[model samples]
Target: MDELVRWLGVQLDADKARAAQWHDLECSIHEHQEGGLLKAVAALEVYGEVPGAVCDCGGPARVLREIDAGRQLLALHLPTPYQDEGDRWPGCTTCSWRDEMDDLQVRYPCKTVRLLALPYADRPGYREEWRP
Candidate 1:
């Protein structure tokens, strides 16, 4: 697999993990009666700087929604191998637009995927070149 494709997958996986963690926390808080300690933990601004901080103001439902959206977007922009002049290149499934001059398909990890990965840029394993 291409390095960029691998990197994008890692980023998306990281997002899912974070969302799962938040959902678990939310569930625990709701299920248990920890009193002030749980309230204080929930009130903390740990995720304040993170994009799409659904856990801050909403419950597990919101975090699940975000996770579903990410999954759908990733599904739409999957990396596919295509043949061009006897050589195979990675291309995007949903980005079928052709370049005017080259008439070639958009490369894998297309603009949509790049933008999807943008929110997790602060996380580890993010590359500067991956910015859209």
Candidate 2:
């Protein structure tokens, strides 16, 4: 249970960093500016210390930061993490970030979390949107 909680914490951090792009929320340990899209990490020392994670880009940094800021909450969404890295259990579907798909995040740590954003209008106003 403890292991599950810890990894989930990491996952949540990654997810929240990306979420900060469209929302005014602190997703990291310190305050940072949002980038062109979600999961977009800001410059070094520009906002605060960069997140030390598996990700090597600003995007993942953004997500991690968001988690630290408490903008998004994470729960054990799955029973396991591929291997036996953690314990598997029932009722692991209580994660809040599990069902919400915002159009700002392109991907997540170790996986791709698709969130598409299309231009709106004649000059940034509206046009058409098609999702399948």
Q: Which candidate gets the maximum TM-score versus the true structure?
A: 1
Give candidate 2 misplaced runs (Cα > 4 Å).
22-132
lDDT of each candidate versus the true structure: 0.64, 0.34
Give the per-residue lDDT digits (tens) of candidate 1, residues 44-128: 2444345544443466457667767877888888876565675356678889556776565777678888887788788787789
Off by over 4 Å in 1: 23-56, 86-88, 99-102
Per-residue lDDT of candidate 2, residues 1-132 (tens digit): 334334444545445644655332233333334564444444443444445422234454554564554423332233233322241322223321333542222112211111111111122322233111
TM-score of 1: 0.59
Report the number of clashing residue pairs per model.
Answer: 0, 15
Compute the lDDT for candidate 2: 0.34
